[model samples]
Target: MSPALVNNSVISDMNTQENSEQRYRLLIYNYLSHKTTAEEKEVLLDWLKQSEENRKLFSDYKKIFDLTVSSDQKSRFSYRKPEALKRLKSKIDPSVSDARRLKIKRLKYYLQTAAAAILIFLIGALTSFWISRNQSVQNLSITKYEVIAPRGGKSEVVLPDGSKVWLNAGSNFRYGADYGINNRDVYLEGEGYFSVMKNPANPFVVNTSGLEIKAFGTSFNVKAYPEEKFVITTLVEGTVKIEGKGLNLSLKPKEVVVLSKESYEIKPDVDKVTTTSQLSERTGRDRSEKKEDISFSKSVQVKSNVNTNIYTSWKDNYWIIESESLRNIASILERKFDVTIRILSPELNQYTFTGTFYKETLEQILDILKLTAPLGYEIKEGIVVIKGEQKRKSIYDNFKTN
Candidate 1:
């Protein structure tokens, strides 16, 4: 099969960046099969030199090529030719005899090149790399697969077990090589929405910052950005168990749990202080009368009867914000639009807004916001500076006093 036949759908579904990625992938495939032209080899070499990430990705593909297209595999493909060739040719359309002939010629070409095109498709990045037929991936050194959504864009990833994950901007999701074969656990940073495949025996776990969300089969959204003070888990459908240090909670559909990071950070200090208080009480120092002001504790709040869409809607094109403060909204807009936002006026942070944005540009959203409040904004060099309209602020302040 031609590389175009294998990557046509992939190129169509992805963005321009992904289309370029597919082109390079084909180049890599051609290069490994020893069919690269002089120009294609230079292009691949230049891409490899661009970054460590590109080099690492190319290295992974090279490893896959070495494993799949070895001398023994070549001999086997050469020996078991009749059945496989017949099965491949059967898929060709009877009406397009010329096309069928062309495909058959391509198949023969692949045989001459010592690599199978269908094998390339099967071992592509979209699917899990099956190292060997006789052994499990667990028996081999684990190869970690990482998918990162850039700061300005979101990414969709399909796991080995058909579990789909939509990562928000500036997010990273990863899993081990033995993902579907032996385990179904994934690590997440930033935020991701998961629509997991139903596997009752094998549980799916999303590991965040010191927190583990275990689900048998469920759809849920996890927001665990490092800058944020809380790790939020919102269950959309089915049930999920949230577990961590001094925290274990089960969430039902439409329920959201917010775990404070301060609680996790102060556990050791809290334990020490508690121990000291107990010792003081045992020593008869009258410490019971002197109350220690320690504000840290295991702060886990589970809110019921909530609109889960408010939390999970970020993954979609239209984002719905409900009574969110300007300060918080700025952060969301920054991630969504991939811009730097700065709030100049402290009073603007006090104002809250509620709106549904439908793929609006940064300027359009800002225009709508200006009508709701005495807000002024300036954009230069991709940085947005938001301030209060001084004249309007004065009128608003007077109106508030009255």
Candidate 2:
């Protein structure tokens, strides 16, 4: 089939960059039309040498070739059915027919010196394109909108505005093309980071669970799951306005908001101190415990969120889940791990699972889950069977026993 047929929509107003792609497509179309010359083959080799990506694109297109072939008796058309493809345009319009016939005549006239050996093939192929055109009709993960990674897998998606998003296993984002325009809107069901494009005119908005975040070009993390009671939004940079029922909270960089149907809680940002203090009494420092004074500064000169890399690393193909819940963790697990999960109890929905594990393989992720909660699991091939148990701090305990 011609590149024009398969790519007519995208090709109609293609720019200069697409012209080279069109040339390569044309070469393939001609080669498949059984009109490839030994000299043209050498030219194709030279083009392939110019770029490695070109070779891969050509190789990947071999699938199109495999799908187009119907029979062996009609061996004259070696590359899928050219006649079917052409006929698809409009019953082989007379203009194209005449063009085909004339092209054949001209080729014959030029090769009059060596046309006798494969006489019938040369004649049939001039008309083969007309034949292929007639026949053979045919035909990310869980995230804010609708997402869940396929089991044992994860994915990374970059929005049009240069903002990066990391989808956890079995998680997916619901972001169609209508992003970065009127609203820069994204609906994520699981967990994701927003390294937003600075657009004062268009504030980025993310909706998950029952909470919504409006940002002014910032970076942040949001975790919302079916089993969890509250939606958690953690700001890592800039500022984010989070809203929920009876809740309108603005979080500064490094601040976090926990919103639930019953109540909303805001956590103030604490100054970061060394988890282990080196300047203690042993190090000749004052042993006074009078309310420690510390300050958490932004990674950027201006006050921004710390943990920028840890927060938005998934966009760069890294999975870093902080203290999250089973309800929320399941959502992130789906995207980074690429699998499906179910919350057996709606009451358990808000049961938070908090741990920090590097994003990776689905099995390894599930193994980490076993360690974080009172749960047992078995992995056979691609399927994982999870058995949940209640712990003293169980989020699921609030609901009735099964």
Candidate 3:
């Protein structure tokens, strides 16, 4: 053959191959849209199995078709699929030879098919970008902030609303970045002294495990230790309301409400003060004092004189115990010093201690307790074991008795 004829034949083969690929792509679109004939479906499947690239191209088109259909349904697009396909087919030229005209006609069909395919691809890309952007916006709406006062430590945090929280030892406080905007919400564990900034429209809410204290521009002390049986809310400067389990109590300044697991009680006399030293003397007494029964009456009010400073002074790092029990003091020391305290003597557990210590070492506090009470302590392996006066008998004594 001549060189010119050979080049013409090669060009013709290339054009035929391109026409076949264009027809295959259109068939794939029809197959995805459930508009293909049985023979066309068989041809599409065979072409997909011919090579990995062909399979990938079919897969990509199918994904775009499904995404576009779903997104169009959600967005309520005005363009119908049949109308789009019909409008695309009307623009083909028909005035050529039979075989060449068929090729050109299919070529025009390929361009129209590409227009719809590209439209669906762009719609899917825009939908994905919109969804991801919405998710990013939702994530940015609220930012969480947390403050922890570890054992033997105290911390102060000023919230976004200019409210100040003084966290005592072993306390956790958390609030969100949108704190003052809609409403001021804070979660508290253990104890916190809050001086809330007043916002009449957006009330402040302090949440504990048992109850919630709602306040507006008020200062209060909350003692909600997980180990303790009572949630104590003491109002210092402003009025506040405590609510839990269908019970509500409105508290005035210098008043305190104590919420137990089953009931709630109010102590009216915040001034009646008893020191822990006075209670310590009564520790070794008879049966009645040993059982500290918590009153569980819903919304029951009782009058007792308590020094309000004793409850709120921990904000100043002062631990004031007027008449607190040794068992209770041990619990406080455990959190304050971050140490385990074991009262070996059951009798010693009932003993009470009363004192005030600011920035005192655990050893220093223990030394003071030894002087004031019949208690001996041994610090071993990160634990303080308090022993009573009755020492254990020697093993030789049992042998001698035998």
Candidate 4:
């Protein structure tokens, strides 16, 4: 298309936006003036059909108009115009160009014309709109979302922007409930797997603790806790950027970025520890996306491997530990059950464990722990107790001694 045509199209779009607001005001005026001619009605219908946006604007205008003007208000008009319109008025000094004196009119008539007359010329500049007077128009654009998982229970929620979140037992997360026309954002606590919606233009963002993960659209897992110092972000598929404190790193699929708890930092590194899901996705060959000359390979590898199932274990209603320090492992148990676990033997912290279990009750999980280590634990009320095996080294030892 020629520049001339492009300019004309943009001008037309602007004109259409302007015409929408004008039509709304006109509709209200016609209703008030009892001048609803067939031609005016046809014009209204035409505008409504131009775009769903036009209908939304029209409906919003009628709501505000009816709310501000009623039977009692019929005798007097008191139109304050939207704040956006008022600001535009100050920008264009309507007093200088379009000022006129009319004969004495009733309060309602004068009020209606006073704002409308000034607003008529400035409508083009007031594109940001306000509707719903009961709730600020801004509130309706985006809402707040919050989800919490109780002890031993977990939650799964799909956000409005099409991102899926899995909250671990005893964990919670909050997000801007509404994904606006141009952007999506969320906040996380503990750990969760996110299969984010893809939008090549606008990136999805997850903010947690001091870390920020940004991606156009991809699947990833983030683990951040206020009680704990470290924040770990693992990329399952697609690309992501991790930024926190004074550190920032871009990651590839199969890579994990661990920001240090003590210094809140990460030395630059490339990671490539494969996941089960990543293996499943590399199956369908897309000719268009593949390049013959370029190598399809990993520039960097991961610090460790993550079983897609165990890495995303919270999503599957199980806790799997693979050579994980007992302290970190217990913390996961704490978050899942919303309880504090005191390690009577902090030396147990030095021990790393590897184990997997299906969905088990809280008591069952703790029992499993006792079988693997010389520790006795019990849940009284909601508190969990971690004790050394007294004089008995194990459940068998206690039985033998008895």
CA RMSD per model (angstroms): 27.0, 26.1, 34.6, 24.5
How do the predictions measure up, each by TM-score? 0.59, 0.39, 0.54, 0.52
Q: Looking at candidate 1, what is the lDDT of residue 128?
A: 44
Rank by lDDT, descending?
Answer: 1, 3, 4, 2
Off by over 4 Å in 4: 1-142, 177-180, 265-305, 390-402
lDDT winner among the candidates?
A: 1
Residue-level lDDT of model 4, residues 78-176, one tens digit each, is 221332353467458856223221111111111111133211111113222333255465646544445654444555665554356666555566665
Clashing pairs in 1: none
Candidate whose TM-score is highest = 1
Which candidate model has the greater lDDT, 1 or 2? 1
Candidate 2 wrongly placed segments (more than 4 Å): 1-152, 176-178, 261-378, 381-402
lDDT of 2 by residue, 1-402 (tens): 334443443224446777867766766666666655565566667878989898888876666876776433234243225534544543456565444431221111111112232222122233222222333462222112233333233344545555655554334466544467556877787666666757889888887776678987876877675555545577766888866544455666665544443333333322221222322221123312211221121110112233444454554455565545566566555433334566554544544554455434556666776665557666554344566666632654454464
Candidate 1, residue 83: lDDT: 34
Model 3 regions lying over 4 Å from their true place: 1-141, 262-305, 391-402
Clashes of each: 0, 73, 6, 10
Query: In candidate 2, residue 290 scores what lDDT?
Result: 14
